[model samples]
Target: MIEIRNLKKSFGSNLVWEDVSFSIEQGETVAIIGRSGCGKSVLVKHLNALMYPDSGEVIIDGRNVFDLEYISLRKMRQRFGVLFQGSALFDSLNTFENIAFPLRYFTELNEEEISDKVMEALELVNLAGTSEKSPAELSGGMRRRVALARATILQPDFLIYDEPTSGLDPKTSEEINQLIISMAKNLNITSIVVTHDIHSVLKIATKVAFLEDQGLHWYGTVEELRDSDNEELMSFVSASEYQIRN
Candidate 1:
């Protein structure tokens, strides 16, 4: 389980999270939803220790992630698989090379082993036939999947995604969410997603954390979101049709 207590962040004067607190259960999928700058992305960074909170704690599976030493922190970081909003694939690498990148960096596996792992990851993301293809040749959804494949190539225990369905059509967005959900269940990875997509919130979120008013507005299951009376969450959910806008 990941426990966050009284967490806070700021940019000199502008506070992001004020006394924020929440818990993410082991192997549970939690969605953090909010407006563009309401600290959703900041919160996910703290989970992987990419950014430190000004105060409070992030206890992941009983270990305080921020308090660990660099060497220990590196190991802790290995437990995380991350997908950024734009897929963020290296333009210089082909699909197979992109998937093999992490193994090359994080493991001492032989060439044959790396090859097999790359294939496994590609298959996991349903992009097996595109190994030799470049990022430029793939569609938006395919690029996103390649990034997902690389992120999970290590089979990390935790998955963190930022705006995974952003910029995709509604159908593609749902497909991406479905893939994310399938990956989570198949690997039993603890998944934390930061997105403004309500469709993602409704379809893939096992639990939801609404960040607004400089804090965690609400943290509970999808049922709680559906049944919530919180003004902020209600506003977000009801702002428009719950589908991908772009």
Candidate 2:
């Protein structure tokens, strides 16, 4: 499990968050939601020690994140799998190479072993035959799935997805949402998903946390969100202007 305690962060004079704390148990999918510029992105970065806070502590599976040495930090990061905002695929690499990138860097696996792993990840995302395609050749939804393939190819112990279904058709969004949940179970990994999509929340959130006012507004089960009386979360769930185009 990951536990964040009394976290605080700032940029010069602007304080982003203070006293932020929450926990994500193993095998649970925690969905975080907040308005734009509410520091949601900043908080997720702290999960893998990508960014450090000015004070407080993040403990991942019993190790203090900030205390880890350089090599330890690198090893710590290997346990994390991140899917970025827009898949962030390299334009020059084909899908197979993209998925194989981390394996080639982190392990001594030969070409055949790497190919086997890449193919498994691609199969999990149902993109088994698109290995030769470049980022420019795939649709936005497919690119996201390819990125997911790349992220999970490492088989991280914990996964963080930042807006996994940001831009896609309704059907594709549903497919992506369901796959996110299925992956957690199939991989037996802890998932921390940050998104504004209520549909995705309702569909896959085992636990939900409302982030606002520089701290955790509320943290509870998905049923609690649906039947919530919290005003902050109500506003997020009721937000109606985030238009999704076809």
Candidate 3:
């Protein structure tokens, strides 16, 4: 489980957010939504300690992530898989090599073992035949799949997706959303998604967290979100022209 308590952060004198608190149960998929520059990305980065709060605690399992030693922190980070907003694949690396990067760095696996694991991850993302292809050779959706394949190659306990569907057409966005759902369900991985896509949120998230006014303005289940009377949340959803999927 992840518990964030009374979090506060700022850069210089510009405050990002304050009094942010929430808990994510293991195996749950929570979508963080807010206006652009509301610190959604910064907030998720706090989960794995890529960013630290000026005050408060982010506890993963039972340990405070910020307090861990370097070696301990490295081990803790290996348990997380992050799918960056841009897919962030190395253009020089082939799919197999990209997926093998984590296994090679974090595990004691030989080339044969890495190959086996990478192939399994590729198959999981349904891109089994594209191992030799570079990121430049794949379509946007295919590239995202390859990124996902690499993200899950280590079978992380938690997955963080930063704008997973940005810049994609609707069909491709849906495909990626389904892939996110499939990964979470199949691996029983806890998921934290920072996205602006409401459609993806409805399709993939069990819970919705709204960050606004320097804190978590709202946090609840998807059903509550759709039926909610909260003016701020309703306005945000309506502004996006998002209709809840029935």
Candidate 4:
């Protein structure tokens, strides 16, 4: 289980959020939603210790990640796999090499083992034949899938998706959503998704965390979110859906 305790952060004099707290049970897919610049990405970054809070504790399996030494922190971070917003694939590397990069760098796996692992990851993403293709040759959605393959190749305990559905058409977005669900269920991984796509949230999230007004404004199950009576949250949801429609 992951527990976030009264987290706080600031940039110079600009306070981003304060007193934010929540817990993510194992195998849960939690979606963090908020308007742009509301610090949703910032909050998820704290989970892997990519960003430190001004005050608070991010405890994973009873250990405070913030207090870990460098080696310990690196090991902790390896337990996480991140699908960056832009996919962040290296254009210089082909798909096979991109997916194999982590295994080569982090593990002692030989070339044959690396090839077998990369092939498995490609099959998982349903892109088994595109291993030789460069990122530049793949469409936006395919690029995202390749990125997802790379992210999950190590079978990390946690997966962080930063705007997974951004810049995709509706059909592609739905595919990505299903992939997210499949990853969580098949790997029993804890997932944290930062997105503004309310429809995508509804389709994939088991729980919702809403950030606003400099704090975690609300949090609950997907059912609770749909039935929520909070005026601000409802307004935000409605507005987001409207944007999707028009």
Candidate 5:
């Protein structure tokens, strides 16, 4: 389980969010949603200790991640797989090399082991046989898949997606959403997605965390979100096609 207790963060004199608290159960997919600059990305960064909160704690499994030593924190971070918003692929490297980057850096695995694991990850993302292709050679959706394969090459326990479907068309976005669902169900990995797309949220999230007003305004299941009467949440939803009944 991942527990975020009373977390707060700020930049200079500007407050991003504060006193946020939430817990993500193992094998659950949670979507963090809010308008732009509500600190959705910042909150996810805190999850992996990529950034630290000014106050409070993030307890992953049992240990507070913020309190871990550098070495221990490095090891802890290996448990996470992050798919960045822009795919963040190395244009110079082929897909295979991209996926193998982590294996080479983090493990003592030889060439044969790296090859096998890279292929396995490629297959997991339905991108097998594209290993020789560069990021420039693939479509936007395919590039995202390649990035996903690379992110999961180490077989991490948690998957964090930052705007996974941001630039894709509706059909492609749906495909990515399905892949997110598959990653959680097939791998039993905890999935945390930061997105502004309500359609993607409906397709992928088991739980929803709403960041607003310098705090977590709401945390509940997708079903509860559909039925919620909260003004802020409803106002946000209204901007999308999801209408809440009074």
Candidate 6:
């Protein structure tokens, strides 16, 4: 389980958010949603210690990640996999090598073992035959799948997706959403997704966390979100739908 306690952050005199608290149970898919620049990405960055809060505790399995030493922190980070917003794949590497990079760097696995793992990951993302293809050869959605394959190759306990469907058309967005759901169920991985897409949130999230007004404005299950009468949340949802339709 991951527990976030009294999280606070600021840059110079600009306060991002404070008094944020929430717990993510194992196997839960939590969507962190808010308007652009509301600090959703910053909040998820705290989970893996990529970013730190001015004051707060991010406890994973009873250990405060903020207090860990360098070696310990590095080990903790290896348990996470991140699918960046831009599908940060290495253009120089083929699909196979891209996914195998982590295993080569982190583990003592031989070439055969690495190949097998990479193949499994590609198959998981339905990209089994494109191992020799470069990132540039893949379409936007396919590149995202390759990125996802690389992210999960190490079988991380937690998966963080930053705007997983940002530039995709509706069909591709739905495909990515379904892939997120599949990864969660198949790997039993805890997921934290930072996105502005409300429709994707409804399709993939088990729980929702809304960051607004410099705080975690509301949080609850997806069902609760749909039934919520909270004015700000309703407005945000309506606005998102309007944008989607236009």
Over 1-246, each residue of candidate 6 has an lDDT whose tens digit, in order, gives: 899999999999999999999999999999999999889889999999999999999999899999999999999999999998799999999999999989998899998999899999999998989999999999999999999998898899999999999999999999999999999998999999988899999999999999999999999999999999999999999999999999
| Residue-by-residue lDDT tens digits, candidate 1, 22-112 | 8888888999888889988888889889999898899976888989998889999999999977899999999999999989999999999
Each model's total of backbone clashes: 0, 0, 0, 0, 0, 0
> Listing every candidate in turn, what is its Cα RMSD in Å to the true structure after a full C-alpha superposition?
1.5, 1.6, 2.0, 0.7, 2.5, 0.8
> Where is model 6 more than 4 Å wrong at Cα?
none
lDDT of each: 0.88, 0.88, 0.91, 0.95, 0.91, 0.94
TM-score of 4: 0.99
Poorest 10 consecutive residues by lDDT, candidate 1: 237-246
Looking at candidate 6, what is the lDDT of residue 126? 89
Question: In candidate 4, which residue pairs get closer than 3 Å at backbone N, Cα or C atoms, i.e. clash?
Answer: none
Badly placed stretches (over 4 Å) of model 4 are none
Per-residue alpha-carbon lDDT of model 2 for 1-246, expressed as tens digits?
A: 999999999999989889998888989999988888888888899988999999988898689898899999999999999998888999999999999999999999999999999998899999989999999999999999999888888889999999998878779999999899899988898998989788888888899888788778899999887788988778777773244321
What is the alpha-carbon lDDT for the whole of candidate 5?
0.91
Q: Candidate 4 on 27-84: residue-level lDDT in tens? A: 9999999999999889999999999999999999899999999999989998999998
In terms of TM-score, how similar is model 3 to the real structure?
0.96
Which is better, 3 or 6, measured by TM-score? Answer: 6
Error of 2 at 174 (Å): 0.6
- Candidates sorted on lDDT, descending: 4, 6, 5, 3, 2, 1
Tell me the deviation in Å of residue 92 in model 4: 0.9
Instruction: Give the winner by TM-score.
Output: 4
The clash number for model 2 is 0
**Cα deviation of 128, candidate 4, in Å:** 0.8
Decide which is better by TM-score, 2 or 4: 4
Model 5: lDDT of residue 163:
94
Off by over 4 Å in 3: 242-246
